[model samples]
Target: MRKALAEVGQTYDVVVLGAGAGGMSATVFAALEGMRVLLVERTEYLGGTTAFSAATTWIPLTRHSRAIGADDSREKVSGFLDRAVGNRSPKVLREAFLAAGPEVVETLENKTDVHFRPRPFHPDYLYELEGATSFGRALEPTPFEAGELGADLALIRPPIPEFTILGGMMIDRDDIGHLMKMGKSLKSAVYSARLIGRYYLGKMRHGRDPRLLMGNALIGRMLLTAKKLGVDILTETETTAFVTDKNGVTGVTLRQKGIDKRITVTGGVVLASGGFSRHPKMRTEKLPHPAPEFSPSAPGHTGALHDLAFAAGAHHGTTSAQPCFWAPVSHRRRPDGSMAVFPHFVFDRSKPGIISVGRDGRRFVNESTSYHQFVSAMYATNKDGSHVPTYLIADAKALKTYGMGMIRPGGANIKPYLADGYLTEGATLDELARKLGIDANGLKDSVSRMNAYAKTGVDADFARGTTVYEKANGDPTHGPNPTLGALETAPYYAVKLWPGDIGSAMGLVGDENTRLLREDGSVIEGLYACGNDLQSIMGGVYPGPGITVGPAIVFGAIAARHAAQRAAAARRGEAGQGEAA
Candidate 1:
């Protein structure tokens, strides 16, 4: 207690690793409670991947929505989580996050300058699917003035440009329905345009630079809260390990360039340094596939913290590393040295893409459920050594639409892919079948039956034409089953699909309380991990829109508060012991 109190500025009450969603919320809450905090990040920015994330946070119901009359309840939230993440999470870990998420949401809204608004348009994935709810109880960060953050803004990353935003001309989901409901009315259109126009004019009037994209809005909002709280956000500093004495964690070691330095912090460390999804060796050994599809996680996602926590004697669990829930991107390069990937734009029967086949050149599983399901099934035959490249059979339409985004329409950038024979097109299914090395008869039989079902909006085999989500999301013009249009139109195409992963979601197992455990299931002292470094509580499945993020924030806060409590208790004990001695 004498040493800890003497360590003041040299050691904080809490040291949080990583500046991601969980870390951000944890630091803010800890600082507000009057705990001295230090947040370390390896990037030049805060937000981690959250800045560029989908900006959609999934909570069954939030105070903001409830205030606006949305029918949401904690009971419903608990029931949904039970069905979703289930027993995969530690009971303590689950309860802590579930209980704290709503409070965190409400706290950020009222106490901070953050702009959090309920997203009325955000849908729970498969919401319209049988047994799903229509009202998506979620919130998004309102567009922010990126410049108000000052130099702290340097610690923030930008959002992906392709997505919709209020500052830009693109139409978002929230506006699409309003436009259709008020279609062709000049007053409505003008009014909508004016609302958007007002935001831009407002930003310029405030003398603030704007990066008001959807995901950026959330990043911008949180950073505002962080700045107001005066929390020190140290970026471009790499954390090599957790420092500890026999008592508990003492501080952290940080590296800049090649120079090494040790900082003693009295506050316990929060290990929010994400997962090993982007790690090279982990990618090679544990992931099902050989590659990644445009993960937004920064380049620094090595297995450092996973290894750090393990070295610090954190208990291992589930005995596996799982792939991220991702959408497969059919990617191609543009002239600007940028790669444009269209997510889950696989070709249907009417369109052209590689014919996705099982090892026997047979189709299995509805290919469009979610990319998580798609990639998992892509490697289903790996144990038998028969699955290599899952073939993509496409015609001209597939080539035209697949890799052509982010380039000028009819531009010369596509000439190389076509010239190098990366894309194949043919008039006959037999020749295309031969090119894909499929059994001609089997391909024919499969196509014939699939076409028959396409004519009637039915998938007799795997029930592919089942959901309106599929129909609305797919090519609606294809008719019948938009997902099952006939490939008889000719100009066939094929590309082999590789088993790929976005990142890993598995790691040191913890109970729902967010405590790091030892190998024998005993809890480790003064250690905590959240975000990807912690084994996912969701069992590596996509249960909602912002699964990784919401819990990350929830558990991150839970860990920080608990760590502070532990520190306070230790200080009290030490003072008492000293007096008695």
Candidate 2:
């Protein structure tokens, strides 16, 4: 299966593998510094897992945050991280992230087309913790027009199909709010009309409205800048082996659309190949049971880069307390007989009159908690190791107001979901318990307790709506406790839940410069890793929105800058020798 090349395919100052947020950022930053860069991606499309994400970046103390009057002081953020990560936190890595993160955002925004808007009131996930602010830290990409990519439009991965409406009209956070209130208010009706009108016009001219938003928009902006700077992008190419001699990572051997090719590089290699979310072996070894079969990430997350790096003598990090970042996901079989998974990030769990229960029909954790905390509680409570599914229970009124999983609000076509076994319905508590094979008595008691809490506006058992984080997810317009309302309506429903990981927290141990380290604490000559491949600075704790993407952008830039600097120094050395000759 192996073939040796008669001659190397090409040479470049830097060769960046993978085209997700990390790799794209690295490519742009490296190219910005005048480095001849070759960016390769395994899939035909760029963006990778990040394209399917919400595209929020949690960059604290950013200029936008400061402008918006955020109190993102160094002491404050550090206190929050200390509580979240504790002893596992790497001080230097955290310091580097805090120092370089804002600059990276500034560079992309100022020098490139990559633009971001501040989420001034976005609360940190653990708002209950000390030093957590009620607002100002997270930044999101502004919507981008896909037409700017031209023929390369097809090369970008689209967002999850569930997030779109009307066969490819991608909606953002603001659009969702407007669409939810459409026809009920005049303002919402006008906003919805304007959004749909533009989508139709875009579709009429282009096969698909290339109006990219969220993660897709973020990647698109980076790709546009890379193209303008003449960065060479090789899609459908995978790095199979790293070529080395006296120095580490001299180049890489790649299989490009099936043909074997070897490319030499003088600068260095940057590995930002997303994460190993889809790798079965890695999942079994690292992640807990009920490992997700339906990830929103790209299918090429096979952990190939991890294997390659490990073989090259890279050591992994010790932040295994929380190995993977998790979210609860609901699944349904599409018309094509494929499973469509939709992550319940902010949609159903935190709404009033909803509670997540285990097989025994007992509420396990605070339903309004962060996705990471919710799933962690699920793992901790599944004591017997049985493969029973966790269920999100809601009544007809709650279902209509806030749809469960793939089911949209306003009671949209539940007949098909029930027929497909994706949703379970019960006219009463006992019937629902029997249908789900849960304890009927336990289910009745749970309902009674919920009704009591709803009436009294207090959840003594789990304190669901007590924190700012929980209230943020709740319907603020609702009564006493926005997250706690009586589930007393008839025809109750439930959707099975599974633990889904966005990316791995445990990764290769690397330094602030993004250089991979050996177990003995020495750096691997020229090998570098960033993104989800590098150990999370938060030490596996999901502190807030965009924590994952923020570090990915920062470390990717750090790796690129380091490689470019080395290449420049080497070039100058060669030039001096030639002049002496």
Total backbone clashes of model 1? Answer: 29
Candidate 1 lDDT over 31-79, as tens digits, reads: 7777777777787766776765655666555676676677666666566
For candidate 2, write residues 461-526 as lDDT tens digits: 999899888898999999799999888899999999887788878888988899988788877766
TM-score of 2: 0.96
Candidate 1: lDDT of 13? 78
Question: In model 1, where do residues sit more than 4 Å from their true spots?
Answer: 1-9, 64-77, 115-131, 160-209, 289-296, 319-323, 333-361, 382-388, 391-423, 430-446, 465-472, 475-484, 488-490, 493-497, 570-581
Q: What is candidate 1's CA lDDT for residue 167?
A: 31
What global local distance difference test value does model 2 have?
0.84
| Steric clashes per prediction | 29, 2
Compared with the true structure, model 1 gives a TM-score of 0.80
